[model samples]
Target: MNKPFLRPESGRLCAARAAFSRRAARVVQFGIAAACVALPLAAFAPAAHAERADNDKPLNIEADNMTYDDLKQVNIFTGHVVATKGTIIIKADRVEVTQDPQGYQYATGTSDGGNLSYFRQKRDGLDEYIEGNAVRIDYDGKQDLTTLTTRAVVRRLVGLTTIQDEVHGSVITYDGQKDFYTAKAGPDVAGPGNPTGRVRAMLAPRNGGAAPLTGAPATLTPSTKMQGTQQP
Candidate 1:
Protein backbone atom coordinates (compact mmCIF):
# COMPACT_ATOMS: atom_id res chain seq x y z
CA MET A 1 0.00 0.00 0.00
CA ASN A 2 1.08 3.58 -0.45
CA LYS A 3 2.53 5.17 2.64
CA PRO A 4 -1.03 6.43 2.98
CA PHE A 5 -2.43 3.05 1.87
CA LEU A 6 -5.44 4.75 0.27
CA ARG A 7 -5.95 3.58 -3.30
CA PRO A 8 -7.90 5.60 -5.81
CA GLU A 9 -9.19 4.40 -9.16
CA SER A 10 -7.29 7.31 -10.67
CA GLY A 11 -4.39 5.00 -9.75
CA ARG A 12 -2.35 8.02 -8.63
CA LEU A 13 -1.86 6.20 -5.31
CA CYS A 14 -1.33 2.55 -4.56
CA ALA A 15 -1.98 0.56 -1.38
CA ALA A 16 1.65 0.83 -0.21
CA ARG A 17 1.59 4.58 -0.72
CA ALA A 18 -1.41 4.80 1.58
CA ALA A 19 0.46 2.84 4.24
CA PHE A 20 3.40 5.22 4.02
CA SER A 21 1.33 8.37 4.38
CA ARG A 22 -0.31 7.10 7.57
CA ARG A 23 2.77 5.62 9.24
CA ALA A 24 5.31 8.19 8.02
CA ALA A 25 3.34 10.74 10.00
CA ARG A 26 4.35 8.95 13.18
CA VAL A 27 8.04 9.61 12.67
CA VAL A 28 6.99 13.23 12.58
CA GLN A 29 4.65 12.95 15.56
CA PHE A 30 7.48 11.74 17.81
CA GLY A 31 8.78 15.28 17.58
CA ILE A 32 5.50 17.18 17.66
CA ALA A 33 2.16 15.79 18.88
CA ALA A 34 -0.12 18.08 16.98
CA ALA A 35 -3.48 17.29 15.41
CA CYS A 36 -2.55 14.01 13.75
CA VAL A 37 -4.27 10.64 13.40
CA ALA A 38 -3.50 7.04 12.46
CA LEU A 39 -5.07 5.71 9.28
CA PRO A 40 -5.51 1.93 9.25
CA LEU A 41 -5.38 0.43 5.76
CA ALA A 42 -5.50 -3.33 6.14
CA ALA A 43 -8.24 -5.54 7.53
CA PHE A 44 -7.43 -5.20 11.22
CA ALA A 45 -9.84 -4.89 14.15
CA PRO A 46 -11.18 -2.60 16.87
CA ALA A 47 -13.66 -1.29 14.32
CA ALA A 48 -13.38 2.30 15.52
CA HIS A 49 -9.68 2.68 16.32
CA ALA A 50 -8.70 0.37 13.51
CA GLU A 51 -10.23 2.86 11.15
CA ARG A 52 -7.23 5.18 11.51
CA ALA A 53 -4.74 3.18 13.60
CA ASP A 54 -1.45 2.81 11.72
CA ASN A 55 1.05 -0.03 11.93
CA ASP A 56 4.48 1.01 13.20
CA LYS A 57 7.13 -0.45 10.91
CA PRO A 58 9.73 0.72 8.38
CA LEU A 59 10.24 -0.81 4.95
CA ASN A 60 12.30 -0.20 1.77
CA ILE A 61 10.42 -1.33 -1.31
CA GLU A 62 11.90 -1.66 -4.84
CA ALA A 63 9.56 -2.21 -7.70
CA ASP A 64 10.69 -2.65 -11.33
CA ASN A 65 9.01 0.47 -12.59
CA MET A 66 6.22 -1.78 -13.59
CA THR A 67 2.52 -2.00 -13.11
CA TYR A 68 0.71 -4.49 -10.91
CA ASP A 69 -0.01 -6.60 -13.97
CA ASP A 70 3.62 -6.38 -15.03
CA LEU A 71 4.84 -7.40 -11.58
CA LYS A 72 2.52 -10.36 -11.86
CA GLN A 73 3.66 -11.46 -15.29
CA VAL A 74 7.36 -10.63 -15.61
CA ASN A 75 9.88 -11.57 -12.95
CA ILE A 76 11.86 -8.46 -13.94
CA PHE A 77 14.56 -7.47 -11.48
CA THR A 78 17.77 -9.23 -10.47
CA GLY A 79 17.72 -8.34 -6.75
CA HIS A 80 15.43 -9.16 -3.85
CA VAL A 81 11.86 -8.01 -4.39
CA VAL A 82 8.37 -8.05 -2.90
CA ALA A 83 4.73 -8.19 -3.88
CA THR A 84 1.24 -8.48 -2.37
CA LYS A 85 -1.95 -10.34 -2.99
CA GLY A 86 -5.43 -9.87 -1.51
CA THR A 87 -4.13 -9.86 2.07
CA ILE A 88 -0.61 -11.27 1.74
CA ILE A 89 2.64 -9.25 1.57
CA ILE A 90 6.29 -10.21 0.87
CA LYS A 91 9.79 -8.99 1.65
CA ALA A 92 13.02 -9.57 -0.26
CA ASP A 93 15.81 -7.07 -0.42
CA ARG A 94 17.92 -8.76 -3.09
CA VAL A 95 15.38 -11.07 -4.68
CA GLU A 96 13.26 -11.41 -7.78
CA VAL A 97 9.48 -11.85 -8.05
CA THR A 98 7.92 -12.92 -11.29
CA GLN A 99 5.81 -15.66 -12.79
CA ASP A 100 7.71 -18.90 -12.48
CA PRO A 101 7.95 -21.01 -15.58
CA GLN A 102 5.37 -23.27 -13.98
CA GLY A 103 2.88 -20.42 -13.89
CA TYR A 104 3.50 -19.98 -10.15
CA GLN A 105 4.51 -16.65 -8.65
CA TYR A 106 7.61 -16.27 -6.45
CA ALA A 107 9.26 -13.53 -4.33
CA THR A 108 12.06 -13.48 -1.74
CA GLY A 109 13.07 -11.16 1.11
CA THR A 110 16.79 -11.06 1.81
CA SER A 111 18.45 -10.72 5.22
CA ASP A 112 20.31 -7.47 4.85
CA GLY A 113 20.35 -4.31 6.92
CA GLY A 114 22.61 -1.88 5.08
CA ASN A 115 20.72 1.24 6.03
CA LEU A 116 17.75 -0.82 7.07
CA SER A 117 17.39 -0.72 10.83
CA TYR A 118 13.86 -2.16 11.01
CA PHE A 119 10.98 -3.19 8.79
CA ARG A 120 7.30 -2.71 9.59
CA GLN A 121 4.35 -4.29 7.83
CA LYS A 122 0.59 -4.33 8.38
CA ARG A 123 -1.56 -7.00 6.78
CA ASP A 124 -3.12 -4.43 4.53
CA GLY A 125 -3.31 -1.30 6.65
CA LEU A 126 -1.43 1.94 6.16
CA ASP A 127 -1.32 3.38 9.66
CA GLU A 128 0.53 0.60 11.47
CA TYR A 129 4.12 -0.36 10.62
CA ILE A 130 5.71 -3.45 12.28
CA GLU A 131 9.16 -2.24 13.35
CA GLY A 132 12.09 -4.22 14.78
CA ASN A 133 15.86 -3.78 14.90
CA ALA A 134 17.58 -7.00 13.91
CA VAL A 135 15.31 -9.27 11.92
CA ARG A 136 15.18 -12.46 9.91
CA ILE A 137 11.98 -12.77 7.87
CA ASP A 138 10.62 -15.86 6.17
CA TYR A 139 7.70 -16.34 3.76
CA ASP A 140 5.69 -19.53 3.90
CA GLY A 141 3.94 -20.61 0.75
CA LYS A 142 1.26 -22.16 2.92
CA GLN A 143 -1.08 -19.52 4.38
CA ASP A 144 0.27 -16.62 2.27
CA LEU A 145 1.52 -14.52 5.22
CA THR A 146 4.59 -12.51 6.25
CA THR A 147 5.78 -12.61 9.90
CA LEU A 148 8.31 -10.21 11.50
CA THR A 149 8.91 -9.49 15.14
CA THR A 150 11.72 -9.40 17.72
CA ARG A 151 11.58 -7.14 20.71
CA ALA A 152 9.60 -5.08 18.23
CA VAL A 153 7.41 -2.06 18.87
CA VAL A 154 3.83 -1.47 17.66
CA ARG A 155 3.06 2.24 17.81
CA ARG A 156 -0.22 4.05 17.31
CA LEU A 157 -0.31 7.83 16.82
CA VAL A 158 -4.05 7.85 16.99
CA GLY A 159 -6.13 10.48 18.78
CA LEU A 160 -5.11 11.08 22.39
CA THR A 161 -3.50 7.64 22.36
CA THR A 162 -0.13 8.37 20.83
CA ILE A 163 1.83 5.25 21.76
CA GLN A 164 5.62 5.46 21.71
CA ASP A 165 6.57 3.21 24.62
CA GLU A 166 3.53 1.08 25.18
CA VAL A 167 2.79 -2.23 23.53
CA HIS A 168 5.68 -4.40 22.38
CA GLY A 169 5.20 -7.62 20.49
CA SER A 170 7.37 -10.13 18.58
CA VAL A 171 4.98 -10.92 15.77
CA ILE A 172 2.72 -9.21 13.20
CA THR A 173 0.55 -10.41 10.29
CA TYR A 174 -0.34 -8.60 7.04
CA ASP A 175 -2.87 -9.50 4.35
CA GLY A 176 -2.85 -7.29 1.28
CA GLN A 177 -6.21 -7.83 -0.41
CA LYS A 178 -8.48 -8.75 2.50
CA ASP A 179 -7.60 -5.37 4.09
CA PHE A 180 -7.42 -6.85 7.60
CA TYR A 181 -4.70 -6.96 10.22
CA THR A 182 -4.23 -7.73 13.95
CA ALA A 183 -1.51 -6.60 16.35
CA LYS A 184 -0.39 -8.71 19.33
CA ALA A 185 0.69 -6.57 22.23
CA GLY A 186 3.85 -7.69 23.97
CA PRO A 187 3.69 -9.01 27.52
CA ASP A 188 5.21 -6.10 29.48
CA VAL A 189 3.52 -3.13 27.80
CA ALA A 190 1.42 -0.20 28.93
CA GLY A 191 -0.68 2.80 27.84
CA PRO A 192 -3.61 2.18 25.58
CA GLY A 193 -2.22 -1.31 25.14
CA ASN A 194 -5.64 -2.33 24.03
CA PRO A 195 -7.36 -0.15 21.42
CA THR A 196 -10.82 0.04 23.00
CA GLY A 197 -11.84 3.64 22.52
CA ARG A 198 -15.05 4.47 20.74
CA VAL A 199 -14.94 7.39 18.31
CA ARG A 200 -16.55 8.15 15.00
CA ALA A 201 -14.37 6.79 12.15
CA MET A 202 -13.81 8.91 9.05
CA LEU A 203 -12.89 6.05 6.75
CA ALA A 204 -14.53 2.65 6.30
CA PRO A 205 -15.72 0.22 3.60
CA ARG A 206 -19.19 1.75 3.72
CA ASN A 207 -17.75 5.22 3.18
CA GLY A 208 -16.02 4.06 0.01
CA GLY A 209 -12.55 4.58 1.49
CA ALA A 210 -13.14 7.98 2.89
CA ALA A 211 -14.50 9.58 -0.24
CA PRO A 212 -14.06 13.27 -1.01
CA LEU A 213 -16.60 16.00 -0.05
CA THR A 214 -18.08 15.87 -3.52
CA GLY A 215 -20.16 12.97 -2.03
CA ALA A 216 -20.52 11.96 -5.68
CA PRO A 217 -18.43 12.35 -8.83
CA ALA A 218 -18.77 15.82 -10.40
CA THR A 219 -20.27 16.13 -13.87
CA LEU A 220 -18.81 19.48 -14.86
CA THR A 221 -16.60 19.44 -17.97
CA PRO A 222 -15.16 22.72 -19.16
CA SER A 223 -14.89 23.35 -22.89
CA THR A 224 -11.75 24.99 -24.31
CA LYS A 225 -12.87 26.02 -27.78
CA MET A 226 -13.75 29.51 -29.05
CA GLN A 227 -15.42 28.21 -32.18
CA GLY A 228 -19.02 28.67 -31.04
CA THR A 229 -19.47 31.13 -33.97
CA GLN A 230 -19.00 28.60 -36.83
CA GLN A 231 -18.71 25.06 -35.37
CA PRO A 232 -21.05 22.35 -36.68
Candidate 2:
Protein backbone atom coordinates (compact mmCIF):
# COMPACT_ATOMS: atom_id res chain seq x y z
CA MET A 1 0.00 0.00 0.00
CA ASN A 2 1.06 3.58 -0.61
CA LYS A 3 2.11 5.72 2.35
CA PRO A 4 -0.21 8.57 3.25
CA PHE A 5 0.32 12.30 3.14
CA LEU A 6 0.94 14.34 6.26
CA ARG A 7 0.09 17.97 6.93
CA PRO A 8 2.46 19.65 4.53
CA GLU A 9 2.83 23.31 3.78
CA SER A 10 -0.30 25.08 2.54
CA GLY A 11 0.77 24.66 -1.04
CA ARG A 12 1.34 20.95 -0.65
CA LEU A 13 -2.14 19.87 0.62
CA CYS A 14 -3.70 21.93 -2.15
CA ALA A 15 -1.62 19.99 -4.63
CA ALA A 16 -1.85 16.48 -3.09
CA ARG A 17 -5.42 16.78 -1.74
CA ALA A 18 -4.41 15.45 1.67
CA ALA A 19 -4.78 18.31 4.11
CA PHE A 20 -8.31 17.79 5.41
CA SER A 21 -8.10 20.96 7.49
CA ARG A 22 -7.28 23.23 4.57
CA ARG A 23 -9.16 21.28 1.94
CA ALA A 24 -12.75 22.19 1.16
CA ALA A 25 -14.70 19.84 3.38
CA ARG A 26 -17.00 18.67 0.60
CA VAL A 27 -17.24 15.45 2.55
CA VAL A 28 -18.64 12.17 1.23
CA GLN A 29 -22.12 11.94 2.74
CA PHE A 30 -25.07 9.79 3.68
CA GLY A 31 -28.03 10.85 5.83
CA ILE A 32 -29.29 9.96 9.30
CA ALA A 33 -32.75 10.78 10.55
CA ALA A 34 -34.31 11.47 14.00
CA ALA A 35 -34.55 8.33 16.05
CA CYS A 36 -32.77 6.26 18.68
CA VAL A 37 -32.33 2.54 18.20
CA ALA A 38 -29.69 0.09 19.31
CA LEU A 39 -27.78 -2.68 17.58
CA PRO A 40 -26.29 -5.79 19.15
CA LEU A 41 -22.60 -6.71 19.28
CA ALA A 42 -22.42 -9.38 16.57
CA ALA A 43 -22.58 -6.71 13.85
CA PHE A 44 -19.11 -5.44 14.70
CA ALA A 45 -16.99 -8.34 13.46
CA PRO A 46 -17.44 -7.51 9.80
CA ALA A 47 -16.79 -3.85 10.46
CA ALA A 48 -13.68 -4.81 12.36
CA HIS A 49 -12.57 -6.91 9.45
CA ALA A 50 -13.02 -3.97 7.14
CA GLU A 51 -10.80 -1.90 9.46
CA ARG A 52 -8.02 -4.48 9.19
CA ALA A 53 -6.56 -2.38 6.37
CA ASP A 54 -5.96 1.31 5.75
CA ASN A 55 -6.88 2.36 2.22
CA ASP A 56 -10.55 3.14 1.88
CA LYS A 57 -12.77 6.21 1.67
CA PRO A 58 -14.75 7.58 4.63
CA LEU A 59 -18.41 7.90 5.69
CA ASN A 60 -19.93 11.33 5.56
CA ILE A 61 -23.22 12.92 6.62
CA GLU A 62 -24.54 16.41 6.00
CA ALA A 63 -27.33 18.17 7.80
CA ASP A 64 -28.59 21.63 8.57
CA ASN A 65 -30.20 20.83 11.93
CA MET A 66 -30.49 17.88 14.35
CA THR A 67 -32.55 17.30 17.49
CA TYR A 68 -33.33 14.52 19.94
CA ASP A 69 -36.47 14.65 22.05
CA ASP A 70 -38.17 12.47 24.61
CA LEU A 71 -41.80 11.34 24.55
CA LYS A 72 -42.65 14.46 26.57
CA GLN A 73 -42.32 16.79 23.56
CA VAL A 74 -39.61 19.39 24.06
CA ASN A 75 -36.89 20.89 21.83
CA ILE A 76 -33.28 19.85 22.31
CA PHE A 77 -30.93 21.90 20.05
CA THR A 78 -30.75 23.35 16.57
CA GLY A 79 -28.51 24.95 13.88
CA HIS A 80 -26.06 22.12 13.16
CA VAL A 81 -24.32 22.18 9.80
CA VAL A 82 -22.66 18.81 9.18
CA ALA A 83 -21.88 15.56 11.01
CA THR A 84 -19.28 13.01 10.01
CA LYS A 85 -18.34 9.43 10.97
CA GLY A 86 -14.89 9.66 9.52
CA THR A 87 -11.52 8.54 10.91
CA ILE A 88 -12.72 10.15 14.12
CA ILE A 89 -15.65 10.15 16.47
CA ILE A 90 -19.11 11.50 15.60
CA LYS A 91 -19.09 15.26 15.31
CA ALA A 92 -22.00 17.71 15.03
CA ASP A 93 -22.20 21.32 16.01
CA ARG A 94 -25.90 22.07 16.23
CA VAL A 95 -26.93 18.94 18.11
CA GLU A 96 -29.91 18.29 20.41
CA VAL A 97 -30.86 15.09 22.17
CA THR A 98 -33.76 14.17 24.46
CA GLN A 99 -36.01 11.34 25.53
CA ASP A 100 -39.72 10.70 24.94
CA PRO A 101 -42.53 8.27 25.71
CA GLN A 102 -40.42 5.64 23.98
CA GLY A 103 -36.89 6.41 25.19
CA TYR A 104 -33.89 8.46 24.09
CA GLN A 105 -34.34 9.80 20.57
CA TYR A 106 -32.60 11.96 17.97
CA ALA A 107 -33.95 14.07 15.11
CA THR A 108 -32.54 16.26 12.39
CA GLY A 109 -33.90 18.96 10.05
CA THR A 110 -32.77 17.43 6.73
CA SER A 111 -35.96 15.69 5.54
CA ASP A 112 -38.07 16.82 8.50
CA GLY A 113 -36.99 13.22 9.13
CA GLY A 114 -33.31 12.72 8.40
CA ASN A 115 -31.20 9.60 8.59
CA LEU A 116 -30.59 8.44 12.17
CA SER A 117 -28.78 5.55 13.80
CA TYR A 118 -28.77 4.26 17.36
CA PHE A 119 -26.64 1.85 19.33
CA ARG A 120 -25.60 0.95 22.86
CA GLN A 121 -21.99 1.05 23.96
CA LYS A 122 -19.62 1.91 26.79
CA ARG A 123 -18.71 5.52 26.25
CA ASP A 124 -15.38 6.69 27.66
CA GLY A 125 -15.33 3.33 29.42
CA LEU A 126 -18.73 3.99 30.92
CA ASP A 127 -22.02 2.34 30.03
CA GLU A 128 -23.90 4.63 27.68
CA TYR A 129 -25.73 4.83 24.36
CA ILE A 130 -25.27 6.84 21.16
CA GLU A 131 -27.75 8.34 18.73
CA GLY A 132 -26.74 9.60 15.35
CA ASN A 133 -27.82 11.83 12.54
CA ALA A 134 -28.09 7.86 10.49
CA VAL A 135 -25.94 5.02 11.59
CA ARG A 136 -26.41 1.44 12.82
CA ILE A 137 -23.98 0.36 15.50
CA ASP A 138 -23.46 -3.10 16.98
CA TYR A 139 -21.43 -3.67 20.10
CA ASP A 140 -20.83 -6.26 22.76
CA GLY A 141 -21.53 -3.39 25.15
CA LYS A 142 -18.20 -4.29 26.70
CA GLN A 143 -14.62 -3.10 27.08
CA ASP A 144 -14.16 -2.64 23.35
CA LEU A 145 -16.26 -0.61 20.92
CA THR A 146 -17.95 -2.26 17.98
CA THR A 147 -18.91 -0.21 14.96
CA LEU A 148 -21.18 -1.83 12.39
CA THR A 149 -20.09 -0.31 9.11
CA THR A 150 -17.00 -0.32 6.93
CA ARG A 151 -17.43 3.37 6.22
CA ALA A 152 -17.09 4.63 9.78
CA VAL A 153 -13.93 6.36 11.08
CA VAL A 154 -12.99 6.06 14.72
CA ARG A 155 -11.74 9.06 16.70
CA ARG A 156 -10.02 9.29 20.04
CA LEU A 157 -9.18 12.38 22.05
CA VAL A 158 -5.41 12.72 22.08
CA GLY A 159 -5.20 16.25 23.48
CA LEU A 160 -6.87 19.61 23.61
CA THR A 161 -6.00 20.40 19.99
CA THR A 162 -5.46 16.88 18.77
CA ILE A 163 -7.76 14.05 17.78
CA GLN A 164 -6.40 10.96 16.06
CA ASP A 165 -8.06 9.49 12.97
CA GLU A 166 -7.62 5.72 12.62
CA VAL A 167 -9.21 5.16 9.27
CA HIS A 168 -9.78 1.76 7.81
CA GLY A 169 -8.58 2.62 4.31
CA SER A 170 -5.95 5.32 4.55
CA VAL A 171 -2.33 4.88 5.53
CA ILE A 172 -2.46 8.54 6.60
CA THR A 173 -4.70 9.83 9.38
CA TYR A 174 -5.05 13.48 10.21
CA ASP A 175 -3.90 15.22 13.41
CA GLY A 176 -6.53 17.91 13.14
CA GLN A 177 -6.44 21.40 14.76
CA LYS A 178 -2.67 21.65 14.98
CA ASP A 179 0.24 22.84 12.90
CA PHE A 180 2.60 20.15 14.11
CA TYR A 181 1.77 16.44 14.25
CA THR A 182 3.53 13.14 13.85
CA ALA A 183 2.60 11.53 10.56
CA LYS A 184 3.61 7.98 9.84
CA ALA A 185 5.29 9.67 6.87
CA GLY A 186 8.28 10.16 9.19
CA PRO A 187 9.71 13.39 10.57
CA ASP A 188 10.45 15.90 7.85
CA VAL A 189 9.66 19.40 6.69
CA ALA A 190 7.56 20.38 3.65
CA GLY A 191 8.81 22.68 0.96
CA PRO A 192 8.76 23.42 -2.73
CA GLY A 193 9.70 20.58 -5.15
CA ASN A 194 9.35 17.96 -2.42
CA PRO A 195 5.64 17.44 -1.69
CA THR A 196 2.92 14.81 -1.60
CA GLY A 197 3.06 11.94 0.91
CA ARG A 198 6.00 13.57 2.63
CA VAL A 199 5.50 14.47 6.31
CA ARG A 200 6.51 18.10 6.52
CA ALA A 201 5.89 21.06 8.79
CA MET A 202 3.65 23.94 7.87
CA LEU A 203 5.69 26.61 6.11
CA ALA A 204 3.29 28.99 7.78
CA PRO A 205 1.55 27.01 10.49
CA ARG A 206 -1.00 29.35 11.97
CA ASN A 207 -1.23 28.94 15.71
CA GLY A 208 -4.88 28.01 16.02
CA GLY A 209 -4.29 27.35 19.69
CA ALA A 210 -2.60 30.53 20.71
CA ALA A 211 -4.54 31.14 23.89
CA PRO A 212 -2.02 29.67 26.34
CA LEU A 213 -1.04 26.14 25.26
CA THR A 214 -3.23 24.95 28.12
CA GLY A 215 -2.49 21.23 28.00
CA ALA A 216 0.15 18.86 26.77
CA PRO A 217 0.43 17.67 23.17
CA ALA A 218 -1.78 14.83 21.98
CA THR A 219 -0.23 11.90 20.18
CA LEU A 220 -1.58 10.22 17.09
CA THR A 221 -1.75 6.46 16.80
CA PRO A 222 -3.01 3.71 14.46
CA SER A 223 -5.54 2.44 16.97
CA THR A 224 -7.03 5.85 17.74
CA LYS A 225 -10.70 5.08 17.53
CA MET A 226 -14.15 5.91 18.93
CA GLN A 227 -16.05 2.81 19.99
CA GLY A 228 -12.98 1.05 21.24
CA THR A 229 -10.85 4.11 21.87
CA GLN A 230 -10.22 6.10 25.02
CA GLN A 231 -11.30 9.67 25.70
CA PRO A 232 -8.95 12.31 27.04
Q: How many steric clashes does model 1 contain?
A: 71
Estimate, for each residue in 38-90, the C-alpha lDDT of model 2 and write its tens digit: 11122121111112111122334454543445565644433443433323233
Q: What C-alpha lDDT values do all the predictions have?
A: 0.36, 0.28
Candidate 1 lDDT tens digits, 1-232: 5576655465555676888998988776552222112223342333332212222222234554433446356343324455444323444444445444544444444445552223333422344333232233444333334444433333323222222212233444433234343334343222252232111122234323433333552232212231123224
Worst 10 residues of 2 by lDDT: 30-39
lDDT of 2: 0.28
